[model samples]
Target: MNIIKFSAQFPVEKSCIEHFKAQRDACGVVCPKWGCVHPYWLQNKLCYECKQCHHRQSLRSGTVLENSKLPFMYWYAAMHLLTSTKKSYSAAELQRQLGHKRYQPIWEMVCKLRDVMGKRYNLYQLTDEVELDNAFIATLIAEEEKDKPLKRGIGSQRQPKAVVVNESSFVENPKPGKKPKRVNHLKMLVIEDLRADTISKTVNEHVNPKAELTTNDATPYSKLFEQVKSHHAQAIKKEDLPKTLPWVNIAIGNVKRLLLDVHHQLTNEYLQYYLNEFCYKFNRRYFGDA
Candidate 1:
C-alpha cells in the first residue's frame, strides 16, 4: 500500500493493535503447553491465554517483532515503507523516516524484517526454465583478511560472490525482429566458493530437480546436467551478460546501484539480508493494486 493509504489504515496505536489482534486471531494462536487453538484474549496484558492450559502468548511472540519495544504502529509503518518501494529504503533512511530516537533499534528492526523475507521465499523452489549466473558485489574486508584497500566493482578482493537465478520463459512472434522472452521471479544469494560441489548444493537447495538449467559454460556448471532435468550452456564472455541473461544481469546491476547509492559500505555478514529484501520486492513486482 502507499503511504497515504497506510496512514489512513493505521492512524493510531490502537488501530495497529487491533489489526495485529485480528491477524493473530485469523492465524489461530495456539497455547504452547496444551496446543489449544481457542485462546482468550487478555486485553489488559495484551496477550492471549489458553482457556484449557492457561498458557499465554504475547502479541509479538511468534513474529519478527518479538521482544521489540517499539509500538505496533512503528512496525506497520515500517512494513508500508518496505513494500511500497522498489529499491527499498536503507536502515538509515528508514530511521529518519520513523523519527526514532536510536539508530540501532531501527537497524535491527529492518534486518529482522529482511530475515523473514528470505524465509518466506525459501518455501518455494524455482521450477521450469531458469537462468543462472554469478556476480561480485562490494563488501568490507574483515580485519583478519584485510591486507590492502580493494577497489570497487568487478575484480576487487573485497567483493563477495553471489548467485543470481531467474525463472525465465521464451516467446517468439513472427512479427518480432528477435526472439522475445519473459522473466519475473528472481533469486540472489551469497555463496562462499565457486567449486562444483558448492554450486550444485546451492542449486539443489533453491531450485527444483525438474528445472531446466541454463548458464554460461563455466567449469563448475559443466557436469550439472546429471542432477537436473536438463542443462543448456553457451560459450560466451562475461560481457555478453546483458544480451544472454538479460533479467539476471539487470537485477545484478540494480543491486550494485542500490548499494552504491544508499549505504556507505556493506559487510559480508549482513549482505544476504539486503539481497533478501531486493528479491522479495522483485518477485512481487506485479502484485501491485491486487
Candidate 2:
C-alpha cells in the first residue's frame, strides 16, 4: 500500500499492533515452552500465556519483530515501503523517511527484514521443469575500481556467484507471433564458493526431488541427478541465453539495476538481502498496485 493507503488502514500504532496480532493468530501462535500449538492470548498484557505451563509469550515473540525496541508502526511502515515498490528503499533512505535520529536501528531493521525474506523462501521447493544457471555479479569493490585514477586495468576483486533457478515451461501449441516459452517462479542463492558440493547442496535444498534440472555444468549436473529425479545437461550458448534462461536473466539484470539506483554500490556481504527483497517482490508481483 502507498503511504496514503497505509495511513488509512493503520491510523495508529494500536491498529498496526492489532493487525500484527491477527496475523500471528492466523499463524497459530504456540506455547514455545510446552510445545502446545494452541495458546490462550492474554488480552490484558497482549501476550500469549500458556494454560498448561503458564508460559507467557509476547505478541512479538518468535516473530520477525522479536526483541525489537522500535514501535510496531515503524515496522508496519517499513514493511509497507519495502513492499510498496519493486525498487527497494535503502536503509539510508528508509532512515530519512522514518525521521529517526539514529541510523543504526533502521539499518538493522532493514537487514532483519531481508534476512527473514531469504529464510521464508526456503520453506518451498521448485517443482516440475527448472532451468538452473550461475551468474557472476560484480561486487562493490569491482564497481568501485571502475573509476580508478590508474587506468592500467583494475585490480581483481572476487565476484559473487549467484545460483539462479527458474520454473520453465515450453508452449506446446502457440498462437502466431507469441513466444514459445514461459517462466513462472524463480529462486536465487548467493553462495561463498562455486564448488560442486556447494552447488549440489544449494540445488538440493531449493529444487524439488522430482523436478528436472537443466544446466551447463556437466559435473554438477550429474551429481545433482542423484539428489533429484532427473537432470538434463543443456549448455546454453551466448545467443540462446536469453531464450533458454529468461526469468533468471531478467531478474538478475533488474536486481543489478535496482541496487545501482538505490545503493549506488553493491557489496558481497549484503547482496543476499538485496536478492531476497527482489525475489520477494518478484514472487508477489501479481498483487497489483502499491
TM-score, one value per model: 0.93, 0.85
- What lDDT would candidate 1 get against the real structure? 0.85
lDDT of 1 by residue, 1-290 (tens): 77788888899999999999999888889888899988898999999999997888899998899999998988888888888888778888888888988989999998999999999998998988888999888877867667766655555668889999888887665245542458868999898877888888889888888999889998878767876899988896767765578778889999999988877667988999999999999899899955
Instruction: Tell how far residue 42 is off in model 2, in angstroms.
Output: 5.4
In model 2, the clashing pairs are none
Clashes of each: 0, 0
State each model's CA lDDT, in order: 0.85, 0.81
lDDT measured at residue 248 in model 2 versus the true structure, 0 to 100: 70
Residue 115 local lDDT, model 1: 93
Model 2 misplaced stretches (Cα beyond 4 Å): 35-45, 51-54, 141-157, 173-179, 217-222
Best by TM-score: 1
